[model samples]
Target: MHCRPCEPRHPDAQRGVALVVALLVFGLSAALLVAMQSEFTLFYQRGSNLFLAEQGHAYLRGAEELATLALVMDHDADQSREQPRDDLGEFWAQQATPYPLDEGGWLVGSLQDLQGRFNLNLLAATVTGTGEDGTDSARFTPAQAFFIRLLQALPELQLDSREAIALTQAIGDWLDPDTITRPFGAEDDFYSGQSPPYRAANRPMASASELRAVANVTPELYRALAPLVTVWPQTPAPLNIHTAALPLLRSINGDGELVPLSEMEAEALFQRQRSEGGFASLDALLEAPAFADKNMEGVRSLLGESSSWFLLTAEVEVADRNMRLYSVLHRDERTVRAVARASGSL
Candidate 1:
């Protein structure tokens, strides 16, 4: 039988195959376009977030400069007065409340008098402990005594007189130059015994948080003490009546006998200082009946109407970004300068 020639393919069938291939190509192109658009959108959002964050940081820096300007102006204004005493009525102190920024974010800053808190670093100045009669031990300075009295005032912390004394001794040991340990205080040995061992500072504490390194300074006690005491100011200073908390004010005595003032008496002092502005002079402060006793004599020079050092904190929020800036300012009779600055995101 002769093979018949193959029949020619129909035109309709060829057209159908071409249509199928065209549909596949179109579908693939559409999918690729959608993916590219999604990637572009994601990249744009990331860049926008980065821009806003940088803008927030810039705003924070501006806020810091404004704070410095305000402080310098405050000093200039104080120069005109017979006695320059910073008080709640002053512009810097009054600015503690948050204010809306002309920009999209808000700004808030406050001045914290460094000298208002007991200086923990002063323990380095003293050198005798009850346990070490022969060896050189640290004698409590007025600042340490103030801390002890402050501790006694916090009955809620349940720290008795003995514990308070021990805490003081421990702090002294941590700060003292010698490695000799007191009866209650911890030296390098005590710290080395912990889970993560460290050594005694054997020097001035860099931060108030270092108090946790001292013996008998539990988290509870530390929490109670953090706001009232400080390792800054280097030298000892007296409590600033304008800015002192009740616990610190109650520890105003030099003799360290559970602060002499009753609740009403303390409250009265707070009321006058808060309402009538702080005392212009130590003599004016001494006029109060609560200060009838002269136990506070040694600390008079520290009790001042004006502060030399201050901490300013500024927080700014822009869109989804939050920024916080911390500035430590040193203010003198003439000008204000930033001693330290730190910033971070929230």
Candidate 2:
């Protein structure tokens, strides 16, 4: 069949439709490509973070193992003592050393003597149980009293006598097994009624930070108390003769009043000792009158002549990443025990 030719369409109009379609296709392709690229970037970042976290964890474990090996190899190497001079424990004994990571990063580890802290387990004990009833009447010894007093001195805290007494009782209750009441103790009844309703640890705290879980312990109080105390697997471990902070020595000498020296004075003394290769003997501390007057026998009983526990705080900086870890280690004859581990990163 014969047909007339169709009229030609407007050239500009036809070109305009084609151009609009092409533009739409191109816009959709660009949007998809952008979306895909964004998703890939997010995945890569997340994976990198996870890898870094894992690397930090591995380095922390490596530190712990190295400490353990030191304990195992040396008979006299105690966690409470300064990090021993052996190869394994030496890494932590020194300041943090950065280790390079696989992807332009680094990791670092550090070790610190836990003996520098007061043993919280000994808080309620006395020089002797030999008063009137063959039982210690006071909840805390003079040494412990001094320690608590130092804790009270922190400007951030405002604990009255009653609150202080309550805290002492709470800590004692948290450690002791039986529900029996000491004069100011808080038992299971006290904690079971709290917001979370938890049971007592009934054992010594694994970490100083555990104080937050005890009854009536406020975060402020915990913050105030944390720097001064530690929880080791055992009691009466030798206090770190070398690393004990000046505040602790002040507490030891203060006779519950913390009167012997100002904080600055105490720090200065400690710095002097550290500069002079640490204290040769605890007797040097007696040069201060407050410590001199103390019952020497009682002080000796409460504080040890050597160290047996350590807290190792380490930080690793790799490229743009930084990580921190806290580890509690206990040393026995030829063995190191890890009590706890915690980590964070930035």
Model 2 lDDT tens row, 217-274: 8887777667767777565465665666666665555333423355666776677556
- Stretches of candidate 1 above 4 Å error? 1-45, 127-139, 235-238, 256-260
| Candidate 1's TM-score | 0.80
Candidate 2 regions with alpha-carbon error over 4 angstroms: 1-52, 62-94, 97-102, 124-139, 153-155, 158-162, 254-272, 317-321, 333-339
Instruction: Evaluate all candidate structures by whole-model CA lDDT and list the values in order.
Output: 0.73, 0.65
Write down the worst ten-residue block by lDDT for model 2: 83-92
| 1-346 per-residue lDDT for model 1 (tens digits) | 9999999999999999999999999999999999999999999999998898788778777877887888888888887888667777788777566767676668777777776677787656553344243322124556666666778877578566677878878888888899988657778888899878888889888788898777777888888888777765666555566777777667666443433356676777778777777755567766678777665664564466567778888888887467898777777666778877788888
